[model samples]
Target: MSAAPSLPVRALAALGRPVIAAARATLELWGVLIGTLAGIIRSYGKGGRRPRGAVVAQMYAIGNRSLVFVAVTLGFIGMVMMYQACLQFSRAIGDLSQVGLQFLRLVVSDFGPTLTAMMLATRVGAGIAAEIGSMKVTEQLDALRMSGVLPIDYLLVPRFLASIVMTVALTILGAAIMYGAGGLTAWLSFGVNPRTFFDPAMVQPRHLALGLVKAVTYGAAIPIVSGFCGLRARGSSEGVGWATTAAVVGSSFAVIALDFALSVGALWLFGGDL
Candidate 1:
């Protein structure tokens, strides 16, 4: 028989188990994300088949369904931003119009994309995970394969594209509503005219483009992360539920992490003065 481990060895082994498991999980997740991206690229290739209906449907679900939710949440976020910043900007600049200038810069540069992605992670990411996890647990994925339907193409590709397109569009819409809300809040609460609270010139093209880039990056990532968790789910309904939770948590973390990275990159690449 092998010699029993010493206390130090036992402790190290115990620590190693969790660390190894987390490393494996992370590697598997990266593989899944890369494979999903490859599948999308293949579908766009001449040798591959593209699925249009699935893409459209997912766009409707991720984009159209999210409109009201994004609108309401972002609208309030803008008002809150105005309430906090109006006093500071007005007092400093002695011009409430400066509030609008500052608001646009802050919202477009950071808050707009980050908040939208986080909200979507909880809602759309969770739903995608649960739905696909249930299918995985039920052997539906195998059935699709048996029927000659590639799950990556029919399921993941559509979601990937839809999320990017819809997220970008929805982010624009939400930002519009948020600006309106900020203006209204500034006018009524701070006695700043709504018109003066808006100056399109204060926002640079880079700011707007970077915001969309962030949104698109997050949009594409959520599906890959959620679908990875879902496709790997096993065991009972409890397992599926856990997978759903994992998807949301993982996607949310990714959204925040990516936002930070992208924000820094944007600043470095474009040199955002604001």
Candidate 2:
């Protein structure tokens, strides 16, 4: 046999493994995304049939079920943020006139969609992964494959469609609650007038567009990432558990990454106006 490798060689090999694994995972994710897109296109083609009421069911599962959790979380966050801003203004600037204006602009353009997506990444992502991963581990996915069905079409497409709609709706609801709660806190805690605290004059059309775009992008990402993790599950129940955890982490990371990229692009496109 050949001599064993040196310590440096072993260390280099270990370092290279993770790099290669990351590259492979990235390519696999892109493949899943492409396959999902293809499945969507195919669904619109001749002889393509989607399950009845599937999209609506998913919408209820993803959106309606999440309403109270999202609303309460955002409401409390808004109150705390407004209180902090008022306190800082009282101590330093002594003028709180622009606080609500700036806060509303930030919420519409960033916080509302980003925070809402983060919450969904944990709840929705885990659910998708758990369900699909269980199916995978039980060989149900293989059965579907044998039946001439594309797994992405049957499994992920409805979710993709529903997520896009629900994410946008939730973002809108969350933003409204956040703003309303913040205004209430500002009035009660700082004696600011509701008329001044509820102003939306500073939010431009571009802000609305950016937020919508981000919400849609995040919605698309979560299902794709979660499904990919699910399909990759191995072994038994433990594999499903691992996939669930990975789905949550991956979905959350995708939201943050997409948020950063979209924000930068928006800033570049709109320049000083943004």
Candidate 3:
């Protein structure tokens, strides 16, 4: 066997300590999320009834409360997308219908799902983390455990289920808002008729399915990352701040990365049908 490392080697090893710790923490977080998922699934099958009120409250919190912001943001996105598409198409065909068709594909398949997810990650993910982290720092999590409540089952599951459902719902809602706003923008800004700005045929079922896939994955990622960071938090207010920040950052990165992967995969499989 080789001898032990020298002092220099040990000193150099410290350089990698942070990286290794981060990697380990990431892996541990994923493990916790996986366990949480399994717990939710197990609870759903033969498990006792979950708190329906909690789930409903979560849905309302995650879904209904987010509509105004989603609407305004997506509406602006739609207008911008329409303006750009019109500018490009006007130089070529000058056909509003064609412009509308292309816009629909680009927005519904990619931007709609991706941007909405990022927005949700920024807002909802941070909120989840802050709340959970505060609870953690306050010893509320331990109290729940002492009270015979499975925290994962009682807390994470409802959030997960609600997030998945709401993100999917919001994707569809945002798409509609975007399309409508784009159509109007096209008409007002580009002389394209409103009637010609929206073509139902442009939105294929494949696009719908792809959007849903993005929504679900992004949705799951946000709450999982956020809740995990929050639950693991220590210290005091600073810890909660760090957890919230981490949730937003991690969820944002996950959304973008997942969007790219899904886009590439779908393109490979469907040859742009997606």
- Candidate with top TM-score is 2
Best-matching candidate per lDDT = 2
Q: Candidate 2 clashing pairs?
A: none
- Report the lDDT tens digits of candidate 1 across residue range 1-274: 9999999999999999999999999898888777778888888898887878889999999999999999999999989888888877767876676778878877786788888888889889998999999998899999999999777777888899999998888888888888889889998998987667787777888888888888899999999899988987899799899999999999999999998898788778877473
TM-score per prediction, in order, is 0.94, 0.97, 0.92
Q: Which of the two, 1 or 2, has more TM-score?
A: 2
**How many backbone clashes does every candidate have?**
0, 0, 0
Candidate 1: deviation at residue 183, Å? 0.7
Could you tell me the TM-score of candidate 2? 0.97
Clashing pairs in 1: none
**Stretches > 4 Å off in candidate 1:** 88-95, 272-274
Question: Residue 256's C-alpha lDDT in candidate 3?
Answer: 90
The alpha-carbon deviation from the true structure for residue 192 of candidate 3, after best TM-score superposition, in angstroms, is 0.8
Ranking by lDDT: 2, 1, 3
lDDT values, one for every candidate: 0.86, 0.94, 0.86
- Which has the better lDDT: candidate 1, or candidate 2? 2
75 in model 2: Cα distance from truth in Å?
0.8
